[model samples]
Target: MRTLLLSLTLAGLLLSGCSPLPAPAVQPTQAQPAPPSPTQPPATPPQPTALAATPAAVPSPDEATPVAAPTSQGGSLPGGAIETLDPQAIIAATLRPDAPAWLIPADPELADMTRYRLDVTLAPDLSTLTGHEQIRYTNRETVALDVIYLHLFPNLWDGGLQTTDVRVNGQPITPTLPSGDDILGLPLAFPLPPGDSVELGLSFSIAIPAGEGVGNYGEFAYQEGVLALAHFYPTVAVYDAQGWRIETPSPQGDVIYADASLYEVTFTAPMNLTVVASGATLDHAAAGEGEAIWQLVGGPMRDFNIAASADYQKVSLQVGDVTVNHYYMTKDAAQGQAVLNWTIAALGLYQRDHGPYPYQELDVVETATSAGGIEYPGMVVVASWLYRDPNQRDFFQSATAHEVAHQWWYNVVGNDQLNAPWLDEALAQYSTYLYYLDAYGQTGGQGFLNAMDARWARVGHAAKPIGLPVGEYVNREYGAIVYGRGPLFLVALREQIGADKMTEFLRQYYHDDAWGIATPAEFQTLAEAVSGQDLDALFQEWVYP
Candidate 1:
């Protein structure tokens, strides 16, 4: 969700101007009107176990044996090829058998990427979850590492997370929560050298919080039968030049800052519920009585998220090889259909303007969230309330486009959203403008731009720098500056350069930094390079000033 209050302001601003273009009267080429199989009888839940009982000595690239190519189901290759010392089995288990070929990175530069295998079960009441996770963490920094930190996001909410059976390299170890309950620090028995990988395992149970009044747009909560699970697991903290990024998240911005990693998850849930998650589902099978297990795999993704509900109805369309699913309640069928159409339009526009979306699937789900929309890896969550309000349709459409834009800005090419919220949020907002321009022409585009100007007007159009940390802004200032003034800066840059150069810059930035972390400095440097002009003055006036 961007800012609910700003969304209201934007709705009025757009309604006062030219109305948005009518949605294209196109129907899905294929639709799934029925839900999945009914709930089965309950059975015994699976227990957590280490992916590999004993750690094996990983071979160097030269000494590694060449494995067979990935099969139809996404297969894993030796991590040695990518520069990590993780065993081949660990890598194999992390990728989905049905993962699209493009989702796997062939680049040698991404060798130190993390890999995770998770086996979790959701309770029948949607009130809690129990799981075990195995992580392959590589020390990508130049220096050796003594301790690793994991962010326990649920600890900050109403209900909490309890972790047990912590182990490192098959050996039991005790973990400490040094920086509050949220940050779990594991002291390695031996310092992990640079380029080396360590296997960590743990079992956890989370008491899912209720959505109302919860923080971060209530992304990690259960509300009205919908479960929005974002950052519900133990996520490794990012270690960069600033050392560990474990700072307490401000109430105004996104919380998770992570590296692109591979994930293989087996989630068991009540059969009556429909689960829409990041990546492609390789298999859906009955686990026991009224439960089913979904086998999913995604790679080179910043984070993983899942939205499950017993009441969800789905509509699907195939855009090329990508399967787009829109999940919503029956009462919101019209809005859900509109969201699906807009999502398809935005996906096509972004693919043409920025770069190809590598994933094989994309999901836009109507969730019980406070924010307008929240973007995940291959999925985005649209707030359900937006569907019930006829006057808020404009904001709803724009928010949908904005979240889809995050596929490129946040998921494919990530940044430190805590410190540089504008890196993705601003770009996403600008991309929403482009979407309107492409889909609805100048009249539609101008109306949306007018809404942005209105948002900036909330702060009296201050000349504040768009490059401030989330904590630096208070109240509505975070939305006013970052979401409002920041995108305007991008429009200004487009004017300073040329429309053609601006387009080139976006494509190059996305392609070059795909599945990698980007910084403001790198963004400016790329702009200068692509435009063949120094961008110091422009960046200074808008970003640094």
Candidate 2:
């Protein structure tokens, strides 16, 4: 158990900006951040050699009694540790109880989840990509399915994406043209019954737009030597309570959601280019003529992302069984190390409070994103600008901690972000407060909250509900509500519920929702249960109203 490398000097510096550090006064709804002033790209440094060839040994389990897994409407969830359960008793005890049925199956079979195996090639100049994929999708819903939907999210960019030769189980199938939406509807020859799986095959190509990213969002285009690909692939759409999430891309906030599944993705690019993606790279081989192939395996993860560059220098630090890696250029080595150090500390704090991080490796890479950073499952992409100025080190540390918290909130505990932005963003923001409080002392944490209050009073006081969708808030109100006031609501909740009980409530919530989606209603039910207090008025004033 290594502690965060926090020194009094660094703590003093981090305490400077009490408000959400570095976010614009009027923040954009989308995560894309305004580009920093252009600076010459730094030369890549040599990659760090492996320090130990063997995997780090796992720590002995703690001596405390293992808490029994919480019971749900069902007797016991699949993969959950055995525990006594009385569904009716649990339901009757809650203040704001949800329906008896679980949103997703209580015992979802991982073998029946959607899985993808992709082999893709990137252009030498990083301008284009050609890909072929084999998809295995299951109909986990109760109803028979007539159509399969694939979201070509990258089409939201200029020049967009092109697809050809689509097939289902090796038989040729015609895909309906892009339906003015980002969806590609593939009608099955016959209805696929529930609990059945379908194999889909497709080939497509994408042209990477070049230039500064749009609307605080860094462009998908090639810049310096890096090519960032977020929604670059045709992702499967989630079928949930609202039906397939086929909403067109909006410049503000994320619009994608899918069930966690397995991925075996192989990316081919110029031999000199280094590919960093959601999962660990399993193999790398040269393809001759200055090209190579990198094979990756990731998931049970919500989504997969790839960021490749020829100039990335890599470093790693070991914490328990997990290895934290930082990628940056020579000029940004200090900043990259700063992110790594903060990530290690945040990871420790979150695992202790929430749950253990299941992944073996966590990556933090320096790239150009519209926002200060974006969280993937096991990896995070941080804005290159944060590494430029030494004076901005505190902001850099804050942003890194915030995104690392997302590994628990958004990545593992999936939520319908499009519908309830606060469920993840607000929780992640509040977790940052916990990190600072635990890392620094009470004075430092209180100061951070004071800054947030100042910002909220100035701009976010008019926000309708803390749980509104991304579209409901305009301009800085998104940050003010989702990031600022939303967390304040949690702080207020902690005030009502004793601190010890608050921690117990969150741990129970995280444990119950691990590897599953959680709604505000579900959270409310659990909160009341853990605190032994009816929270109707509190939730109404801060959460719903």
Candidate 3:
């Protein structure tokens, strides 16, 4: 969740001075999402310490067992030709019938652990949002659940969020706020047993903050005619091996840890504003004289984000069956196209190397935020400033590629971002290396590594252990270790075990943990399983060191 802030150094790049114009409200249309690109076996498997001419060969559909392999005319191709594709279609094409085996599990016992139906109305001035959420949750844990916690992430900002009333299973309940934090807890009137479900109706409001961020920590910002609403909802906290994860937002890095669940959102806003959110758009219609309602469905994803602006424009391209969209303002027309190309290329490269992207669409929207790029499921908010300087084009590309990589590392494969930031962040940074390798080959890939090494040295090369919580390091040290040194660990592993085995290890890891949170220990176990050698010494030097 690194926020790459690009200052508006280039003049006349944003149309912030221009008067806002009304945008026409149109019904949302469905598009076909892409399928996995076909893979061919390697001509000769490279020996240890050798990089393969092509990327390491991934498991073909036939060898992965019981799971139905993609068929030329059935799984990949659909309805005689390219027909309609939605989240369900994307899942059917990309996921195995027994997807729960490796990906996010949806057993009857745990399918509805948390389900949210949020109905929201945006103010005409684009400064606030009023909403009520209908949340249906089940006590899926083995023990009797006594309390439920909801995280109000936006509350961390000044004039941020307020919860009005809450009811559990239709009975009004007083919510208790945690001390010096943004968490609200509701003690269950009666202990909720496993397999039992309850409904919570909550009312809340959020006021979008106005101003530039201090660093890479802007959330409720309204600037340049764009409104970025990230982590704005009162989300249910995750209960895992350590119980409820009720931690508050931290300044150093991402503080969210959640289980993938379903969401159906209804957003009502001024007719002129366009809504871009996680998942797929199910419906859109006129709400009233000057308002419209958009129905969106997403998940089982860890989080959902919605961004809107009156001045936003979009350019889209079809890759295989999937549609990749780049949203930008009038000033970023040229940069918008560039982002779209890089997104499409990155998606293809990751799909070929890791696995199929199990979503119908991916959006890269330009926004003003603290981060250079912030990732959400099937969507990301990219810094508009990245487009201002022509000389820093590579920086823009690397940032965009890194965020897109999170679709697999952070989105599909869930993680405890608060406890083990390296699990996803390090892998995402390494993914940029992979993208460079796939796009520009060995020479360019090594160049990216050399740049990373130089940056690490400039940061004084502290040699801190990469496997640590977000709070352990300062912001700069966090970036230096996780984004810079963390990737080098993978490079060293590649050198030790060969590129083919390293890629195979990653493929296995992705396949096994596609739908669940994984820790460094789990990764090490998988690494040893695939490489047939102990990596304790290696991990000690770079990761645990």
Q: In terms of lDDT, which candidate is strongest? A: 1
> In the order shown, what is each candidate's alpha-carbon RMSD?
11.8, 11.3, 13.0
- Model 1, 25-57: lDDT tens per residue? 342244222211112101111221211111111
Q: CA lDDT of 75 in candidate 1?
A: 21
lDDT of 2 by residue, 1-545 (tens): 01122232233332211112233434223432222112211112123345321121211111111222334322111111112222222112210122123222233555665776677888877778988776778898888888889988767766378887888766778898557746899888989999988778788888887776542265355665567787677889888877777776446666546677667667888877666777656557777798777766666678887887766777677676566777775556555444666777788888889877766678887776646777777878777766764444545666788888888788778888777878888888788888878766665476457646654765837655788777777766766777778888999999999888888998888778876888999989999999999999998988885
Q: What is the C-alpha lDDT of each candidate?
A: 0.73, 0.66, 0.67
Error of 2 at 249 (Å): 4.0
Report the C-alpha lDDT of model 3 over 227-335, residue by residue, as the tens digit. Answer: 8888788889988878988876456677568877667677898877767787766566777888888766676677888887766777676666566777777677766
- The weakest ten consecutive residues by lDDT in model 2 span 56-65
Off-target runs (Cα >4 Å) in candidate 1 are 1-104, 107-111
Candidates sorted on lDDT, descending = 1, 3, 2
What is candidate 2's TM-score against the reference? 0.81
Give the Cα error of residue 493 in candidate 1, in Å.
0.1
